[model samples]
Target: MAKLYFRFGAMGSAKTLNLLAVAHNYRQQRKKVLLIKPQIDLRFGANAITSRAGLTCDADLLVSEKSYFTLKGNDLISHDSLKKDQKNEIVLDNKLDYSCFLVDEAQFLTKELVEALYEITILCNIPVIAYGLKTDFRNFLFEGSKRLLELSDTIEEIKTTCFYCEKKATHNIRLIGEKPVFTGETVDIGADEKYRPCCKMCLHKLKSR
Candidate 1:
């Protein structure tokens, strides 16, 4: 049976790049793979996933919370060639007939979407893989990440060193201008300029003094 996999990381941990690599692996084997990204991430325009290392490809599907539910047997999708048009044409409904579902920036997903994803593997026989930030800037659980933690068959953390201390970082620090701030919505679209990865010790120490 296919499994639901959640791979999470802090800022600058190459989550998207890893997700893309997985896609490449599947395609190289002649297996159908779908690349999905939440519509909320527009840092590189709509329907595109661009890694900081310059690896990029157009997303097969740009989805929101409702993509999991938009399918209700309306799809006439056949064969396993996995064309990009097939993805955009099929409405996301409870009936998951696809080979695989992959989501990037999954931290933006809603709780309902995550639950539906859990069902995709168990009840619908579709494998689901999601990659995203594990925690927000304020060290709180993103609704999507929280749900994934509870429902995922396997949870993996992608590790990287802290931006300032060179320690193993587990947190994403948000910067407004030149200074760090602990405030804001969970999803902010900024690359390199607005976020930093920090270790737990540095996080606590920075917040304290």
Candidate 2:
């Protein structure tokens, strides 16, 4: 059965780069892959997903709070060609289209959207791989990440080293200059100048008292 996956990490975890590479691999094999992104993440560009490492790709689908997702592509090709057997295994369409779905900057996704994605994975029999930060700079879980944690079939963390120390970074610190800033909107989209991947100890020490 197809699965919904949540792969999360800290600020500089290269998650977007990995997502792009996976999409490329699928397309290279002559398989169709849908690249989805939250409409709120325009840091790179509109309808584009970019990594701090400079990799970039245009998103095939831009999901908003009110947007509804289905198995149809931009070409209006319906995925109704598929059928399920008595054993609950999904039989593919004659063309074997839509190999997978990849989502970038998924932390801004709404809970309803996440549930819809989960349904898409199971009902459509398409694997959905989502990449985003597990928590905000304040160490609070974003709505999308929280829902994914509960609904995802698999959860994984992308590893990165702390900017302040050699420990594996598990926390994200919002910084303005050398000091940490604790108050701000939870969904600030930025790169190295605004956020840092830090260990728990470094985060505790860096936060202003």
Candidate 3:
């Protein structure tokens, strides 16, 4: 049976870069790997999956909040083109040919979709590797991460040290320029400069008056 793997970290933890490398390795071995990204990720472009370290790839699929995800890439392809283009029609026709599935910013996935992904792994026998932050700046678990925690067979923390301490960083605190702030939407998008990774001790100190 295939396993669901959840690899999580705070901001600037190189999760996306790691994901790209995994995809690269699979392709280099002559295996077909499909990359998936949630549509909420606009920091790089809605459809492109990019890492702060500069590695990039065109995600083979984009997942919407209310969409059904099969092991196939049919959900992301345009329907009109599917009708006009014979090549595309054939691609969607037998969509289970993908060897692997990789998702970046997996934290943005909807609860329903995460469950679907879990099923895709269990029944379809495809390994699903998900990368994203476990918690927001407010130190609360994102919906996708929450479900992933409960569903994944293997859970690994992509290790990055706290910017302010030697302890392994598990918290993300948003910073505007240089100041640590406690305000913002749960899923605000920004470059590495806008967020800092911290350990629990530093986060408590910063949060306390």
| Best prediction by TM-score | 3
Regions more than 4 Å wrong, model 1: 70-98
Q: Under the 3 Å rule for N, CA and C atoms, how many clashes does model 2 have?
A: 0
For model 3, residues 47-154, the per-residue Cα lDDT tens digits are 789988888899888876645543354443233323333322222324466788898999998776788778777667888899988989987899999999999999
Scored against the true structure, residue 155 in model 2 reaches a CA lDDT of 98
Report the Cα RMSD per candidate. Answer: 6.5, 7.6, 5.5
Stretches off by above 4 angstroms in model 3 are 70-93
TM-score of each: 0.85, 0.86, 0.87
How many steric overlaps are in each model, in order? Answer: 4, 0, 0
lDDT of 1 by residue, 1-93 (tens): 789999999888998899888888888878777777878899999988988889998888776643444346533323234444434343555
Give the higher-lDDT candidate: 1 or 2.
2
Q: How close is candidate 2 to the true structure, as a TM-score?
A: 0.86
- Among all windows of 10 consecutive residues in model 2, the one with the lowest summed lDDT is 83-92
Per-residue CA lDDT of candidate 2, range 53-87, in tens? 88888997787665544433321222233332211
Question: Model 3 scores what on Cα lDDT?
Answer: 0.81
| Every candidate's lDDT | 0.80, 0.81, 0.81
Q: How much is the lDDT of residue 94 in candidate 3?
A: 48
